[model samples]
Target: MLEMSNGSQHQTMKLSKNSWILILIFIILLLFFSILFFFRSKPEYVSKVDIALGTTVKVVVSSDKDPGLIIEAILREFHRIDRKFSVTDPKSVISQINKSENPVEVDEETAFVIERSIALARATEGAFDPALGNLITLWGFDRINDSAFKPTIPSDSQIEEALEKSGYENILLENDVVILNNSVKLDLGGIVKGYAIDRGLSIAKEMDPEATGYIDAGRDIGIIGPKFGGEYWAIAVQDPRGDSGEYIDLVYLKKGAIVTSGDYERFFMMDGVRYHHILNPKTGYPIRETISTTVISPDAMDADAFSTAAFVLGSEFSAVLLPVLGGQGLFVDAQNKATYTEGWSFFKEKH
Candidate 1:
């Protein structure tokens, strides 16, 4: 009886020991998984700065990928786009198209941009024509390397001659080739930078689809996704008349692009008159209705074209036109009056 009782006790103890071991193993595995989850949930931030498209290109990425690799990739992509679309690069596709009177073959990217540019012109009723290269040069904007480069207003006759050559209808895209009429010179300055931003952002997103970041191509800005903290990025609308670093309004957006066109940035003063770069397609002179215009859209290219159109269309027309195109804008007129589209109110800063 004693032997049997001892045997029973030994077996019970062995079973209890086995249960404790299993529980310990389960706890260790739970700890390992918990640590992994914690690390994966955290965000890592990476940023890069380079000069491309004749301006500063800054990219900020938030992801778990190596920051160095992401930054390097972003910079490389910016330079590639710059080479393909640069108006001044002698070997660029754009430069070749400008020099060639016949239809010139180009890469798919260049062809797509040309098509989109033409479509935007038609959609805005010629308010955002890319064929104003001749007029832009006539106004001496092409010679501008900085504010120090003095500019002279084009003579009335000069403006007329340039306008005669300026028409979006003159550009022809047949198959994968682009043709500029002999009189027309191609300049993608107003839109190419925005397109470059879109392209660079795509590379960063491809590196990590869930990552968030912002690409600042000179004055134009495009956001990839929500911030790491899961909030919209706050972007300030530059005050057209205010000093540098001053802003008139604030915009909050989780994704997409924000671009502003203002008279203050690239204008020349002669005899107390300002001749800015935002020229009207019909008149071949600066549009004076609005001092500044801000556009928010799904991408940088559309935002850029819309901002230019909004500035030319003035406040009243832009308020109506923006909603039709599925975008938004905030326009400040010469009288300091601020007007915004219906969608603007949703992202406008509460103050």
Candidate 2:
């Protein structure tokens, strides 16, 4: 009688385990279907694209109200920033400051930009430099976008001369006045586009606080809000070695900025050697160690500047540096090896 009772208890336990396994399988299937349904029913968005800030600028938004006005306002803001900050535009304030030998008195906004740039330069120990205008000119990169641009390598002596005339130490600020010494020219190219993104998003938010979409200025994106007002957006990083649309990796984000600095952007090949525009201030030559650096940050200015700084400073240093600056970064070397900060994986979707 005892053996028979034990046999019946074992059968009961086996049946209970089977029942739970079936229930768990059903639950997972339900979740998978639910996700598909949610994505299929995502909210629609409207977008507009125009050329601004020396790159293709696109604005996308989904709001309860019409997004047309908001998009126009944002584009107008980009044009305004471009007008004020374009280093190539002789009429722009930056060009005027670069041309001026005396201390240039600037507005509060310009002063803030200069001060922030100097601060970032110090923070990165001269990795992200605005004082590279002279070096840029020596390489003729200042005219890279022009139709008549001719690619020629600068002599080592010329590079050395430009290096001597350039450094963050050339800048001195005194209560809304900017003084550039040692032939250093202020090129806010590193940080201006990010500032434009931030300002464009702010304009969208001011018009509608719950604006859902993103501002993509030449592929450096700043999220205005969550995708479809709830879901995360899968943002792709471009592969430096691949074609224009080819992607290297992807990171999912609901908010903030994703900015990339790659050697492929503005480059000229010379006798089988590709000469790109991302020059190291320290070496007065193009950086060869890093192929690209992408940064995710709460602010686009930080994202923009740090991406450039990381491209010059190498991937390992950014592992510690970016986190302290409220950023997560991915650094890809010339051999295509990738390095990520500790928090970078958290932004990626789990497989």
Q: lDDT for each of the candidates?
A: 0.83, 0.90
How many angstroms is residue 264 displaced in model 2 relative to the true structure, after the best TM-score fit?
0.6
**What's the true lDDT of residue 276 in model 2?**
88
What TM-score, over all chains together, does every model reach?
0.84, 0.86
Tens digit per residue, CA lDDT, model 1, 1-351:
112346446432234677889889999999999989987654466777889877788888887766567778878888898888766678988788887867788878788999999988888888888888889877777667655666888789998999999888999997988878857877777788788878877887888787787888877999977777488888888888888879888888888899988898678888999889899999999988889999998989999898988999998999999889867999999898889998898887533
* lDDT for model 2: 0.90
Runs in model 1 with CA error above 4 Å? 1-43, 146-148, 349-351
* Model 2 CA deviation exceeding 4 Å by range: 1-43
Q: Residues 70-139, candidate 2, lDDT per residue (tens digit)?
A: 8999999999999999888999999999999999999999998889999999998899998898998889
